[model samples]
Target chain A: MADMRTPLSRARGLGSAKKGTEHFWMQRVTALANIPLMMFLVGALVVHAGSDYTTMTGFLGNPFIGVVMLLLIFSACYHMRLGLQVVIEDYIHGEATKLLALIANQFFTLTIAVACALAVAKLVIG
Target chain B: MSEQSKPARPLSPHIQIYRWTLTMMLSILHRATGVALYAGTALLAWWLLAAASGPDAYALVQEVSSAWYGRLVLFGYTWGLFHHMMGGIRHFIWDTGRGFDLKHVEIIARITAFLPPVMTLGVWLAAYIYPGAL
Candidate 1:
């Protein structure tokens, strides 16, 4: 299976696909977005603790709150996905296992994001 | 044939080779907390989805969240969230290329470690003292 190319020739064309910077940039962008979003989220959760169904829904149902909540879900999930991808890539060594883990990471993050978004949208819309 | 063709190579010294520093610990803790938050997101999703579902479902979630174990996990999640958030801020600061000096880096690392637990405790304390004043 070995090709007879010189080592320099072998290594010359094998490095970076030129798209890694996008991943790096997006990770930072989403991270910056998460700071304020998470603060607002934590505040809302604290304020809503022990609230009854109607009360809780009424609060989350507010257009402004709901919109911010939606934003939080999006930013947080995106950030979470990016962060977990790094984690998986770092720790999952087996080729097949790494691929499976990366796929599962995407699916899990997508599920959480969609489910959370739907919940917020329903409450807000209703 | 392939097995005989290549000999086993010597491995480089790993994590165990070095003494742990606060900066090293914080860096690892940042990733550790990030992983914790990844799982914590599920709890958040569950809470939101349950609220959307109906009163019975929402109440079940509330009941569980109010339980001792649930509260413990929530406490850990709170700490993890704050810890990770501070770690991110430290990273952002470093990204600006301002915190690389040895003295400053150690100071920044200490702040990352100290602030989160304090903030977490403050939140919990406020929640207790004022009871949803937030």
Candidate 2:
């Protein structure tokens, strides 16, 4: 290929977005956080699997459990967004479709995070 | 004119063209399980919403989840959770700058494949043994 850039243009490197590694780093961080958070969730669920409504709400309504549940909700949703972005980028080829999917991924994860957090807060605070 | 100067080249071989390895299978499984777990969040959200919405909603969720199909789905979720957890641990091992050797990779992959089922069974058994103990 023929060189098209001026010497000054070549000298100036492609600008660092400065946030290039944020997605990767956050994914790993959330994945690490999820280990304990999700295990707590699974353990809680298994123990309360057949419980009545009172038992279920009572367990989840406790302050500590509520906090942990909120953490899990946010972390998992964020991690889900990052993971799905990779999948969408890999498989969705159409430019408009890919852009729409990426936007939808963000919105969906945010909605889940908010809904779960709000539900937990309502239970815990009431 | 510039396009004419370039030589026509063969495309690279895709996944189907190569012999599949345990590592390859596990790698894909990791992503597949991740996606499954992502969908499983809907169940989580439903549970939370039901619990917050009061007894009727909660009972409805309970009713659905108690059915055979619900158990089946929950069982799958249980397995997927452990499977994805094991896959994450494997990646963690690699991230720490080790476990790249073919033998070690395959060995870890093999363990990841079987351990999730055993763990899932153990958990279910424990849950059955001590029902609703939270």
Candidate 3:
């Protein structure tokens, strides 16, 4: 196996497109980060369930919860955008359609991420 | 590399031609659940924004989400979230260059399939039954 590689091919490791497993690594990194963040989020929701707006805002106002939530939104959205791009790439055969879908995916994920972050910031800052 | 000149052959046997396997089903489910969560998180956003907007808005969101149909959607979303989360963990383990063994792969897929519903039920039960205790 050690002898089986062309020197150029062996060193790059990213293949021709040069993405170099970037998506794979990012997916794992975000997934690992999301585990605890999501747990915290679910906990917060459960604790605040059926409570009034004041209680929900108060829960999110706590600095630690607020920060965990921010991280969760950012990482989860990024991971999702990556996953969806792959999905679009795989199923959409038309090149132009695939590109448009990819762009729309990013736009949608980014919009959600921004909206969620703004909501968190408002709660934390107020 | 001409289109019409190429020999007649199936492009590739996608899901249509191949016998389904646990890994394949789980793989597809992972993506399906991911897409579901994409929408599910939109609900989360609505909740947050509703909270930020004011009491009236927040109450409306609360009323909507707590409605029977809303709860049903929420339940489905919960299952999707947990299922996708477990699937991520499985993929993470694979990224570590382990868990690809045939025996363990099936085991992991089975656990991934069953554990999410159990966790979702547990959370919902606790949330609904012991509202304040949580």
Candidate 4:
């Protein structure tokens, strides 16, 4: 058996899974995606910051804005999950607690993302 | 598997006496900013749900978000968002294995550290004065 990989490479937790660059790649992808999406979102937020009910719903209810919001929610939540996963792995020493926290982190992120998506969908379609 | 009562491995670098550098400070801030954004998303959810719910709810959220305390939080959120983004960019550059030189790294670190507040202020100003220009 010729295992040629360096100990340093192996120790780095390459992929944190089976040759898995998924987490690292996804984090960067979402980070890149967030740049432009945040611009769009910040613009929308500024316009709607102090706006009234009609103004708020009216802008958000637009099909374009609704789609963008959905995209942003998805990307941001995934990024948040990945980021928190790193934090959890680094700091949480107890195996059980780390596992629980990682699971909870995804669930929490999904709940927020879903809630936001539902709100946007309702505004858009209704 | 039997666990040893007195286990192995001592963690090093002696954290208490560690000298903080700009890059190190920004590295920690990135995670802090990330957690802040996680909490801040609650406000976004509230606003959207309020809009979906009705005018009353919408107005209520708006009232709170426009209040001084609300504005302060919003401003901090804005800064956190931008700063984390800058930190992300810096890391991305490093991930690509470019700009590891001390001078370049410090320059990027300084920019990431200092620019967010200014950007946040500029954003809010543009938000108020120009009112749709950004």
> What C-alpha lDDT values do all the predictions have?
0.87, 0.88, 0.85, 0.86
Query: Interface RMSD (Å), each candidate?
Result: 2.3, 2.1, 2.0, 3.1
DockQ winner between candidates 1 and 2: 2
Candidate 1, position A113, lDDT: 95
lDDT of 1 by residue, B95-114 (tens): 99898999999889888888
**Which parts of model 1 have CA positions greater than 4 angstroms off?**
A1-18, B1-10, B131-134
User: Model 4 off-target regions past 4 Å?
Assistant: A1-16, B1-11, B131-134
TM-score of each: 0.89, 0.89, 0.88, 0.87
Clashing pairs in 2: none
DockQ of 1: 0.46
Give the residue spans of candidate 3 off by over 4 A.
A1-18, B1-7, B131-134
- Cα misplacement distance, residue B61 of candidate 3 (Å): 0.8
Best by lDDT: 2
Ranking by lDDT: 2, 1, 4, 3
Candidate 3: global Cα-lDDT? 0.85
Candidate 2 structure quality by residue, lDDT tens digits, A101-123: 99999998888898899899989
Clashing pairs in 1: none
